[model samples]
Target: MIKVYKSDKAPEKLAEAGYTCDEVKQAILNDQKDKCYLCERKVTTDYQVEHIVSRTNNKEKVNEWENLFLACNYCNDRKKHYYDDIPLPNQLEFENVISQTINLKTQKADFRISKINPQLAKLKELLDKLFNGKGICRNLMENRFWNDFMSVYRNFLRRVAAYKIDPTEENKQLVIEELSIEQSALGFKYAFLNKDAELWSEFQDYCKWNK
Candidate 1:
């Protein structure tokens, strides 16, 4: 998952109508670029304004914008307050210490760590399960998740390939746009780059965290 930043000043409607209001949801969708914060998948109708720390564990932070995030239904249900201590994406950028790779043939995600820590480990486990399911529930949903991620990922790769073959200004611009931080399925996009040293060398600068 990529790091996300929320506006310092909460939306005015948040105080008037609370977090469930359309204004608040739109604000979150704007900040998150209409993608799930955990999975980095583009979300439209299935988006949920999720609480990073569950309400059951920390009720006080429920209405706070910093604690709010955008999530797809599957990721939200799957997470379900399991990791109360998992670091916030806004606070800790997962891409800094964690490296994600995928097996093209098998479509299985592999996450590598540059450093070891409890929070990072939990984040890894969370991502592992989200991308690669476990048990009946997750296995049932895994295909949908992978399909959604791969759709964007394949298109991104195609853009890269086109740029590589043509090396024209238009093709290069397309690749650059596809690799924008606001694009969906960025975790997989970045993983693809990290897997190919040559591509990574050419495109690494474009794969930047949102400031």
Candidate 2:
């Protein structure tokens, strides 16, 4: 997940037409980069205007711009009326707080706290609940995670194939840089390719150099 910035001009309350207001929808979409705040999944047309703080707990904040977020139907349904005290993505640095590892064979992602901080630990726990809780069926959740993982993994494989055809240092470096960025956002799928251990090692070395 990434930190989404809200626009200053956003409406203070839901429009008279209710949640279907084009202006509010456009604003939320713009702020969220057309991605769900929780799962970081791409959301095009079908998405929910989720409430970061549930209306059941705080009705006053229901239409507040800061409390509104874009969410996929799966996440929205799973998160309905649930409120956790964990820090919101906009309130914390996402990349620094959480790290994810993926099993290439299963395509299941395991989220971990990236640092020793207490707040980050709480964030990790909250993420675990959202991802692995009983709200969604286990098989469905795994499939969703796997689909997102493979979408990026397939692209990584294509890059590797291109590099194999023209074994140039520049081509290899390009793949490394791209994969490093993808690994940061989509977890370790690209970095976990055991079929090309030498190439993966070089990518790791490049990551360390850049860090």
Candidate 3:
């Protein structure tokens, strides 16, 4: 049966730690290795949380923890206000740093997140990808395509310097240069903010593939 966490006295702290009914079910399976709590079956089938109490009888009481239980697909389906289920008390860790973050500058609304507790060493390994990765920098650099496109293009630029690919052309036209998906997506065809990026990107694409 499912339990709803609800009460007039129910603090925001409880609701804050609480996930939706769907999340509670996932937490059980994640924590329990997908075994039926009662029958202890290696249930290969989908399962649901059974609500001991019907939620339609008390919609306001939908998130109360006492009203719910882990249920196999065969046992719990559409019985009622099945939504009030909360994950176990130990399962709901409210103060861990990784659970959620606030993006106060950009959004008027608060954003919440959930995750397995990350290991410090494992988390450190990701710092390079986070701080040094091109995807992270692209936004910070005002939506410019960073490393991937440039690496290929840099090679092309080297080739261009070696030989005059444009024997017929006298002067390079800024209006016409090369671009990649990243630049095109940003709609900076004119390269108004970045003529140099356009030049290097265009020249590199030309040198690499033009021949």
Candidate 2 lDDT by residue in tens digits, 96-171: 4566555557535567675677766765665666555554555766566657646766676677778878879888
Ranking according to TM-score, highest score first: 1, 2, 3
List the RMSD of every prediction in angstroms: 2.0, 5.5, 21.0
Question: Which residue ranges in model 1 land beyond 4 Å of their true spot?
Answer: 136-138, 195-197
Best by lDDT: 1
Error of 2 at 43 (Å): 1.4
Which one wins on TM-score? 1
Clashes of each: 0, 0, 23
lDDT of 1 by residue, 1-211 (tens): 7778777889999978889999999999998888888888778799888987899899998898888889999888888788667788788666766787778897788887678788888888888888889753446569888887878777887888888788888998898898787787676677777778887898889888774
Q: lDDT scores for all predictions?
A: 0.82, 0.63, 0.35
For TM-score, candidate 1 versus 2, the one ahead is 1
Residue-wise lDDT of candidate 3 within 140-186, one digit each (tens)?
A: 43222233324433443443443344533433432234232111111
Better of 1 and 3 by lDDT: 1
Q: If the candidates were sorted by their lDDT against the true structure, best first, what order would they fall in?
A: 1, 2, 3
